[model samples]
Target: MSKMFWLSCCVVLATCFFQMPTISAGSRVHRVRRIVGGAPAQVPPADDPKVYLRFAGKAAQIKGVLDQPHYVFRGIRYGLKPSGKDRFQRPRQYFLEGDIDATLYPPPCLQTIPGDGRVIGSEDCLFLNVFTPDLPDGTEGLPVVIWIHGGGFRYGSASQYGVRNLVGKQLVIVPIQYRLGTLGFLSTGTPELPGNAALWDMALAVQWVRNYIGYFGGNPHRIVVMGQGSGASSALMVALSNIAKGSISAVVAMSGTAISNWAVENAPMITAREIAEYHGCPTTSAMILLKCLQNVNAEIIAEGDTILERTRLTNRGFVTGLNGMLGAAPNAEGRFDGRSLPAAIEQPPMDDMTQGNIPKIPILTGITRDETKRAVESQYQSEIIEKLKGIPNFMDQVLIKNLQNCTHINDAAKNGTKQSGGYFNLLNPLQFRNYLKIARNNFIQGLSKIAEATNDALFNLPAFLTADLWSKKGVESYLYRFDHISQNKNGFGHLFLRGLPIIGNNTAELNDTVSHGDDLAFIFEARNLDGSAMDPPPVLSEEDLKVCDEYTRIIAEFARTGKITIDKKPVEKFSGSNFIQIAKKPKANNNFRFCEMALWAGLADRLKSSTCQFLNALDTTVKSAENLFFDTVAPAQKNIGQGLADTQKAIGNTAQKINPLNLFNRKPATPKTKTN
Candidate 1:
């Protein structure tokens, strides 16, 4: 949708393993042999009423530590261990037996840590955790939120986020664990090795929730699927599946979307072949590849995943993910004819979105102002510098390809040989060269502009495009820009990417820095990989706390009612490019990065009287609508209390105050007090 839709997954791969040293266990003991990954499950006293629950005709002795009025059930099995023979396949549902322990944090899915490439996590990891405020016995149940944790679809687990903030709002929060990397998404473009095992794992978790969430006081029909980074797009992918039909009521895709460039793998077969060859498996046939990989040690696959990254980087000259944010990710399955199972992603997300093939449910999607700011400066610095070494070649090879894809330029126009001066030939070739100069020069200074451009290409533009496309298709799509930076310098990105490289290492500028996944810090509690609370827990000032409360309230309200209202005003949907700027005090705004999006959309050359008249006309109308809303509609709402005489007086003066030049530059209207 956002044609230049590189999208915001830059941080998913780079920052996913920032905290690896602390997470990777030094001992080789299998996690399943113990009670849980972290401290042993604290069993409740013999007759504690709050420590028992029955569901699916079986009893579970749930373990929990009190956080005021909420109860958390940790390490609940939703599916059997996707290991050994079951590797790289759909999750097998695990039903609770007579008595089960749901007390400790489950082991995370095995994967290689980002920085040192050391492997952490376990293969026997397919579990979920539940957090609830109450266990109702009545017919009515609390709205449910199925949170899919984001690790660029490579790393992370259910225990990474705490539930105190959300569960306290009377929500039933279920964070489920799924397969990652090669084990989760390797495919050979055949039924013998169909990909998207991670997506299937997610679908099965959703099914588990729909079938048994009620036992924990949750309404299956009111489930809201939400996630950050890779999880965000994964949530949308799950909702689009026929398997998950009628299970998800709404979606909250925070930083990523179904159409984000990094959301799906384009060269799955090649990726699978490469992974197979790296692990010493023959890629002559899919069946052989699958069999050999199935028997290979899980750690070797996780370690060999870096081979995919190195090959893609040397071959493509880009370094964010091995392919797209991870070694293996979701892929379109419709290309194959004979499939043994239903496809999770039938086609590319952009195609599905363009065809209006989205779930008929309200969607809340958006991006952080500086989505990949840290990512570009940190994880991608060396690669970007290498590309900059040969600017012209890099531009011709990578940036130009991106430009062509975004503009949908034809082959003839791309060559710039056949066509004279025309709109299809990038309208003005000089302007394109000038843009490159600016980017190159800016990167020479620091990573700030590079980060900004990366954010626009990857995160900002895609989010806007997703909202625009979904809104056009009769879906209620609400968008927002999270601009608030907490006093503690805390954020989902900051927590995960902490202790890593910083662009300037200037703590004073934290108030201005908002990275991808930052908004989640305000809604969910941050925790260690083992589900233990942060030692010296993060502290928020009173002001920060208020913002946290407001942020969480907005999410809870959206789950309860599809409408999202910030302050007392209803947020306008993205059909008109309207979005709320979330801050200490939220305010509605329009035309998010309009000129920049236009430049990226290849409409810059057509901004004047040219071939793209329809787009120009639409742009003009959008400006007029902004003026009309503030000058007419907005004033009317404020003046209504002044009786008919005062309202009519305001309307009469509206015409004289109108000015096109000042339309786009106006700040939010300040309330004025009339003389008594």
Candidate 2:
């Protein structure tokens, strides 16, 4: 009798929950508990005090909705609209007017979807969304996380991510939108229009949070700026900037950094002028160019962004001729842009990082085991193989193009190389040829190998470089590699299974590798651009949710405290050999692609001299011999060590003489005495 009575009560409650009516926007209803991963929930009445707040010397009412686990305030304008005369200008802080509605998701900054090329979004798009677990009353609040979305700095929005998972962890999450493409990053190197408006927008948003997040139960002092992909790059860039210097507490840069080869735009003026000319804008004077560009249609300028990455730029020591990778990226700014203040990114990101000019704060950065596996398979596999077949001298032509961008560090003035550009020329012709052979052979065998090479040069190496550089400066650097792939179709790799012909959205069904953006599925309950639930839903299996739980727990712990730990053990500090391998069983690992990275590092130093051409083949051949001799013969010599040690030194010195990367042996070229 007792068991039946309890069972009847449980059934009655479940029926009531399922039958609850959704409140319309205009109509008012009593507060009803909403289910997670369902339709948008309604907010409290206008008279409720939680819907109101005072910020920037004015009273404002937010139309936030109850989304089960948390309260989310969407499309709150943080900066003035960058339209009309304000186009291409630095962002100015926006204040709320009387009874302003902050409900709908703001339009994304103008950009064309990568594969479709259909331009969407608006010019008046400088808004941020805030998600809070619960509103506190006059006490020190929760640690804040300002999430910057990644779409190569062009296509992502703040609205795409539903942060119920994060907010449920007793933290506040804010996702802010910035300008993209030509409008966000076109510079003429003049006073009238200094570029990096997008960076400025980011800085201003950070400042906005520093000032106003307290009103929404967020601790301003404990702000963690986190991002993925180019968003990750932007997060690091902003954290290192003077504009948002003291505002950020910690930085979580995932899979991208400011030091990534593709992050900084080497020549902004060239791209700026091309964009100006494309829109029929006057390019004679800075003032005329700014005026004309400001007046041009925003969509026309967005379309012109394709011009930003037409030529195949050097990545470390190679060029893939892969289009759509970088488009109008961030660049260094002048100290005096006629704005009475320093530029946000005062110098190249690599320069600032190497010189230890960044903030004294903890940083968490890492990448997937295969960051661009699907990207290579989807976008450039066919093109690369076909080009190799068609052009007999294609590889040679690519080597020459890479040589032009080379920086001879020994004596830049004498070698005709720019010393200050931060281009570490990491491969000579022979070294690059050998490297190309890997890709060529992989093309014949399997494309995954080519993808591995690309990942090493692009994401993996950059991540390690960031960790190594920061660790050298005595900063607490935490690094990880997300090796866990979901059991279901919840990973970002699933997006590539069927879509338009683009790297991120490809029509290919090659789904073996854990591709780029895969970790994001476990981080946020993602939605479409229109703020609707994703079709077919990103349903997580039991195993998949375990990974998600672990991912969130690590991030949440880091946000609250400065340290990163997994399963109650502190993650190892990166000294080139320490990092967390995030898998079903998370553990510390030693070194990531050490030999390949050493090869690149050696190539950078050895290629400094003009004599690299002749020594390339000799260097490659002797290096292999040195490895064989040392690995096989050196161990045997240990038993009879004293006898062969002298002979071994002689052979090693001989090998060093021919090694192309051996810079110490090459004596300075002294001026020859003239004979009378």
Each candidate structure's count of clashing pairs: 3, 0
Best by TM-score: 2
Would you give me the overall lDDT of model 2? 0.66
lDDT tens readout by residue for model 2, 453-562: 55766677678767876776677888889988665432464332122112445534554456677788778887876467888777777877788877888889888887
Model 2 misplacement above 4 A: 1-51, 306-326, 390-429, 432-442, 488-504, 603-676
- Could you give candidate 1's per-residue lDDT for residues 463-538 as a string of tens digits? 7667876786576788888888766553456554332222112232344678876677777777877788888776
TM-score of each: 0.75, 0.76
lDDT of 1 at 511: 44
Residue 667 miss distance in model 1 (angstroms): 65
lDDT of each: 0.66, 0.66
Worst 10 residues of 1 by lDDT: 623-632
Clashes of 2: 0
